[model samples]
Target: MSHLLELFRFCPVCGSEKFVENNKQSKRCNSCGFINYINPKAAVVAIITNSEGDILVCKRAKDPARGTLDMPGGFTDLNETAEEAVIREVKEETGLTVTATRYLFSLPNTYKYSGLNVPTMDLFFECDVQEISNLTARDDVAEAWFMPRKEIDPEHFGLASIRKGISRIVGK
Candidate 1:
C-alpha cells in the first residue's frame, strides 16, 4: 500500500500516530487538528450489448492485465458524472460512441498492483452503441471486438471488477 502513502499520510498538525475516526469516516490527527479522509474513487464500466446480445470486449495493452479481454472503462475524472465517464472511456478505448441505457450495479473491489493496494468503487452501466464499425484500439487498449457471452473466459480478464461485472450480465 505504499502508493497509498501519497494519498494517506500522517497529519501535519499532530505528530501522534494515534488518530481518531471521525463521524464522516475520516481519521483525525490526535496531536494536531488534522483530518485524513478516504475519498471514494469512481470507475465507470460499459456493458455494451448489441441487439443480438453480443458484448464488446477489449484486449488490454497495459499492465494489470496485458493481452486480456475486458470491458472498456476507466476512472472518472473530477467534475465528470459517472454517466459521462462511462461514455468517454468507451469511446476512448473502443472508438465507439454509446448511450448509457441504465445503471447496472456497483461493486467494491480491491487488489494489489505495483505493490500498492488499490481500492476502487466500480459503477457499471448497460449501454447501447450508436454505430458499430471496425474499432481501432487506443493507447491503453490493444484491440477491440464483440464477443458472444458464452465465449468469455473469466481467467483471462484483467481485474475482478470486470469479471464480476460480466458475471452479473451473463448470470455466471
Candidate 2:
C-alpha cells in the first residue's frame, strides 16, 4: 500500500481488497492468486539527419517537456517491431518516411506521463530519408527543424535518454 500505485486498492478479478505486493515489480490478488506485473514499456527514437548531417529535431507541444527539443519517435504499439515503430512514428510526427535504419543504441528512460513515472526502454536508430523537402511538423510537435551537428547540445534536450544519446553521438 506504500507504493506509488496506491490507487490500485482492490483485486481486479474478484473485487477483493487483498491485493498485496508480490515483489518489487508486481502485485498479487490474494483471493484469486492473480499477479499483475509492472513492466518497462518499449519506445523508439529516430535519429534522422539531412545530407549535411544536421539532425532533425522537434519541439514538444505536450507536457513533460513542452517546448523542449526532441527527436522523431514514440512508444511502440502492441506487437509492433522497433523498426516498424520508428517508421510509423516518424511519419506521423514528422511526415518523413524511413527507407533504411542503422541501429545506434538503447537507453533506459523514465517518462513522466499524467503524473505517473513510467519506465521505458528507448531504442534509438539512425534513420535514412530519401527526401527532406517534404517534411513538416504535425501530431504532438510544436515545430520541426534540422540542427547542425555542432549546435546539437545535449543540454538543450529535456529528456535524459536523448541527452545521453546525443552525448554519445558528439563523443562527449
Evaluate model 2: give its lDDT: 0.88
Clashes of 1: 1
lDDT (10s digit) by residue, model 1, range 128-150? 88888746688589988888889
Tens digits of per-residue lDDT for model 2, 13-106: 8988999888877789989998877788999999988888888999998878888988888899999999999999999998998999888999
Candidate that would win on TM-score: 2
lDDT of each: 0.78, 0.88
